[model samples]
Target: MAGNSDPLTPRAKIAVTAGKAVAAASRAAGRGSGSVIGGRVALKLDPDLLARLAQNLDVVLVSATNGKTTTTRLIAEALRAAGPVVSNALGANMPAGITSALAGSSDARYGVIEVDEKYLAGVARDTAPKCIALLNLSRDQLDRAAETRMLAEAWREGLAGSKAVIIANADDPLVVWAASSSPNVVWVAAGQMWKDDAWSCPSCGGVMQRPGDDWFCGECGFRRPTPSWALSGDHVLDPHGSAWPIHLQLPGRANKANAASSAAVAAVFGVPPQVALERMYQVQAVAGRYDVVQFQQRDLRLLLAKNPAGWLETFSLIDPPPTPVILSVNARGADGTDTSWLWDVDYTRLTGHPICVIGDRKLDLAVRLEVANQHFQVCENLDQAVQLCPPGRIEVIANYTAFQDLRRRVGN
Candidate 1:
């Protein structure tokens, strides 16, 4: 009784059974329709079960500050294009989510799972993936996660024992430092051919030499080596262009980074980089991250701004004349408990009076935007936002939940 009553004893299979039982109760209670939250509760029922169960299949672990879902999705797509590959296609990045995804797979030679940074260590212990892709780290969810440096350090320590081939994003200092720990690391970054906005050392707090596509820390002189898989383009780069010219369907220079990251992993697994790029371009948007739609006579392009960094990236994609725009903030606790970071983003750049009112914590967003006295059609929810969308090239930039809400409202 002293040693055996542990919660995670019987492992993930036991967790699965317990989860199903709890799910039945949740369905009875009319709770969430998602799998991760409750399934996570169930996953704790079995600790070692996942390791044992995962032994039969080769796995790929993909984690990033922003692009994990899109990159992993593209990686899975390329793998599928080549042959059969299984993954958590629904953007479940935690262990419980992993369990929920694994529940659906029948026969998969390769398992691609996007992992959450905080939980990666525990998950990695159980699921020693055949190849692990450590994407770049950034500041996000300061309330929940430590700084980017802390996450990178933790991840490096967590993945030590696994013999899986390591795929690292070489451009970011945090990732570069983590890659140093693994001797078998296969470094991947958008070749020194894309764009460089960062010039600060993540460590030592010094300026960096933006020499070409690569970077050099001036104070410490910690230089990131040229990545193995790289994008090929002058001003025009395929985000997935390590397999350049092959990926035509996927557009945008930022997308080239996404595609390149996926191509890197696919290449390590013997899938030609070009083939991966071709498969990636076949499907463009990863859910809400810049999905375009034809609305009435105008183009409603949905760009998801999860944080300040994402908003900055979205601004890079915006080159057209600064027209009226609507930025939606989700107030739902489910989206995230905090809505304060709206101020962190440089929303002031789109200087022209934004048709921005209030949303989500409607008062909060409107109050912030109102500092600039931007026009706002304050709505109770997304239903009202869809109604307020003006005609002609409507750019619908939103947070996580609002993106789906808007899509459903527009009937897209």
Candidate 2:
């Protein structure tokens, strides 16, 4: 259904049609949403299909180790106030999944994409985004992804000479170093909760000096840029010093930072801060991050935390002590094969809560919890885990694949 002005060729049209058919078949087979496989088939038919599908629409690319999916969803919601926007709302951030999303909505006026950190440069080249949001960079999927500093360097090199307006996090040193190459950047003082990855300056390999919410490199003079937009407690302050109070349905301070970044990106698209914030306030969940579902007379709140940085933020979102928490983890390909990152998290924080562990890697988690001097019950499955808990609201935090499995089982 692409308009006449769009550059999709006859072969590309056929590819898109075939991809739709494949997607339909995949959905029927219950093999997943079929976005990635469908787009893979389309690209096989037409290697230039992604660029062709992205021809005339304004595009925005969001990339980060964490919060890419949530921030992409927030920005997409805010942009929808302006016009029809197509986005990978299901947390699909790869090239294939992105192409599938665009191909599904040919007539959309705007395309908001979530690009994986490693694939940001390639997707940006194809989409020619109008704006790019660079959230914090932290170590995730270490078995697969490059180290934090290397990824920051790659972002810096990959985004060089691009015409896109970069909306970056000023509080994250890795993000600042990555976005500094761009001539046009809107810096947002989104607070970074996990600072372990940025203790050393990425620019000069020198020790970083932090004093009173500001950071500077002692060896090379690299410092945190003056933010045009900042998050001050419960309110977001614009460059003009106008504070917009954010009342989002999402929980945690991490989401507040995400909102600040989203509002900045929406402003570049000519959306007012108030309008953008109002629109973003409507989003209660991203993919399945904070969805609550019923299971065996108990309310299960589903939370996804993939890395140490993510886990640090997720801990604050849980209900207070004695509210019972269920922690699940998996070391599948989607999640990193290495479970060494488990040592990085402070599981001891859940000391007073009734905790249950269930996953493919439950034993590994049990060892970590044991080492942390925390008491927990190791269950065979979710049913056993829930049965052990008193019937009430329980928090469930899972990593990537385990979260998906729980979503399927709970039918959320």
Q: Candidate 2: worst 10 consecutive residues by lDDT?
A: 1-10
lDDT digits (tens) for residues 1-412 of candidate 1: 0122222334555677777676667767766435675566665766555565466566788887777787788889888865667787768787777876765554666788888878787877788777888776766665677567788779778776668788887777777776677768877665422123345676676888876566888799888866666655522132343235545444455567767777778877778766777777667667655667776656777777676667777766763655556677775644565777777766666666345543556677777776855656676664455456666666677777776677776666
lDDT (tens digit, per residue) of candidate 2 on 375-405: 8999999999999999899999999999999
Top lDDT prediction, candidate number: 2
Candidates' TM-scores? 0.83, 0.98
Query: Against the true structure, whose TM-score is highest?
Result: 2
- Backbone clashes, each candidate: 13, 0
> Which stretch of 10 consecutive residues in model 1 shows the poorest summed lDDT?
1-10
Q: What Cα-based lDDT does every candidate model obtain? A: 0.68, 0.92
Error of 1 at 74 (Å): 0.2
Against the true structure, candidate 1 has what lDDT?
A: 0.68
